[model samples]
Target: MPSSVTWGLLLLAGLCCLAPATLDEDAIQSASHKFMLNLADTAFSLYHQLVGPSNTTNIFFSPVSIATAFAMLSLGAEGTTRTELLEGLHLYWKEVPEAAIYTGLLNLLHTINEPDSEPWLITGNILFANLSVKFKDEFLKYVWELRHSDVFCLRFRDAKARSKVNDFIEMKIQEQDLDLFEEFDKDTTLVLVDYIVFEGLLEVKFEAETYVSEAFHVDKKTMKRIFMFRRSGQFELLHDEALSSWVLLQHYRGLGPTFLILPDAGKMQHLEAEVSQEHLTRIFHSMAARSASVYLPKVYISGTYDLKATLGGMGITKVFNDGAELSGISEGQPLKLSKALHEARLIIDEIVMDRSGARPSGKHRSNLLTVKFNRPFLVILMDKNFNIPLFLGKMVKPW
Candidate 1:
């Protein structure tokens, strides 16, 4: 016979496999989409707050990964800590049951993990706890069922233990070569690590022969050289006078599409001020498909953020303090989140094809209008069906 802790972990893993299959497909998707949108809104709000007044630096992050970590942590919270976690995530627990939220998240993981899905998305979550402290069975069950996260019990003070945790994360996202954590504090009681790695090819790829090194304006006076990709096709375009930006939608092989927002001269700040869930949804719906010649630079952007201050700014203060009410995780031991670290990287490259085939006639190219991204712009990689933004950021400088 196994110990109660071992039995609990086994049950948790079993439940994860069974939960999504039992729920109604449509209801699960609907609730999952709503929850993800709410989380994305909160994540973007946090981004704007972190970037501050100086918006010159490039920014990139995985909001879905951050939100998923918090959702898992919320399961062990009690009283004020629980309330703050839920509200901070823009999730209303009263209207949505805890089971539903977990089930919905499971459904989303299933969709993205499908064998045939393009723009392959892979996510991993882990909870590292002190060896002396024992986690409650209920809390472990929720983490496993909701996020399919791996739970590890290790001595934080031990150097080998920290290396083991880092090794596991590296192996999970090895295709992208991401290292999520550099070191763990010896005094740390618990830490949550979440990451997302996405790689996709454009449905209509750029021709390598046409690739040109062009000038990318960092600002009015500064410029940098970058390889620009060109493609001529019908894309959904929106010229929003209110926001003073041009919205262009580009589809990958998968379900979600990436939206590029190029602000008119001197209007970047104005458009950033008006960003919100409602505003993004409105902009997406207002777009109409049109023929255009698009030129965008190939980019590889990566960022690491220590989110403790940002979470505090969003009214999630209690979880990081010593007196935090996390009784659900352990009754006798007082545990609070000591560190919240997030690191994300995105690689956008063209899928160069063989040019042996005949090219389009000259007449075909005459009707296409030109749209060039020579200045700074915002990119939103979102799931079209759910209005969920998997990744969001701005490219201010290529380097």
Candidate 2:
């Protein structure tokens, strides 16, 4: 079994928060799409900064989760701190009112996380504050009503407080064990955590017998043995001349399709350097459905990341320092973000044969072409309608 990779988004103190007020559904959707695009751009930019060109490690994180947490934290931000957060998130205060943005985010979250929604997705937010700190009634009310997050009070210095926080995270994610925090000191005042979990089954299940241990080329000189899933069908394929990459779209039962980008041999670095949300938007819009045989590895990635440096690099400073202003949250006791921690686990596996044991027929045998991801590739899980990235990652070395 390959070791699971952990992806984390940690924002230490003074971020943003979101909520829903009164707004038209259509207008809210439109506004939310715009917001998601900007957020996606910021997410990709942060990812690139965290995983520089020299690293070959597998990368994964939920942009929506991190953005949701920031949106919530933004509620308490004021002055230049607030401006930096809004600009950093690609939010133009002049164009869209802050209330509308919050409303849009809430509607978007509700739509994606609806109980009956396909491709099971779970998203949640929580805030743990020191017991001594008195959060303002307005801030608490908005966080609960708009963001749908729960607030808990904990003694930061308690030895058992760390275990309690960890327990809450585990329960929320349905995982048995998770160490969300190692230690809490006197300086630790507030902790904010967000998570997103997706379990998607391919619309067309892959046959179990076709699975095989294949050689996955980590690079030109290195290869690792990994299990790969094989299937042949009509798919939306694009040979992006601009990016010098082959883009493939694989549909899940519900929600948006997963995009897999395979750059030409030895061109991964160049593509990564040039890739952006605008470029991806063009490629996805240009894709046309065609018959092809697709081979992708069975991927399971679990990653943990500290996003302090990444957020700071993106010009979101001041929030971590003592001069930070979060008066909207508390009355008098000055509070700065003490810690931001995020942990996520994602498993991408093919759905086994049904009870009838049906197999793929020779439906598209006439124009069958082969497209295999035998090397490092990039994956983006997104909402088809809004083009919002639920999860973004790069698979370099599977292990």
Where does the lowest 10-residue lDDT sum fall in candidate 1?
1-10
TM-score of each: 0.83, 0.84
Residues 1-399, model 2: lDDT tens digits: 110000001111111321123324455446656665677776677677767655568888887777777767777877777677767766545766454466556666776767777676667778899998899876776677555787889998998999999998888888886786788887888887777777777887655436667898988778888887766656788778777888987777666767889998888887788877777778767779886777777777766666666678778776766878788788888877777766656776774633454445666543578777889888888776567777788888776
Model 2 score (lDDT): 0.71
Count clashing pairs, candidate 1: 0
Question: Where does model 1 exceed 4 Å of error?
Answer: 1-37, 93-99, 160-162, 175-183, 207-209, 351-368
Specify the poorest-scoring 10-residue window by lDDT in model 2: 2-11
By TM-score, the best candidate is 2
Model 2 per-residue lDDT at 189: 86
Model 1: lDDT equals 0.72
Backbone clashes for every candidate come to 0, 22
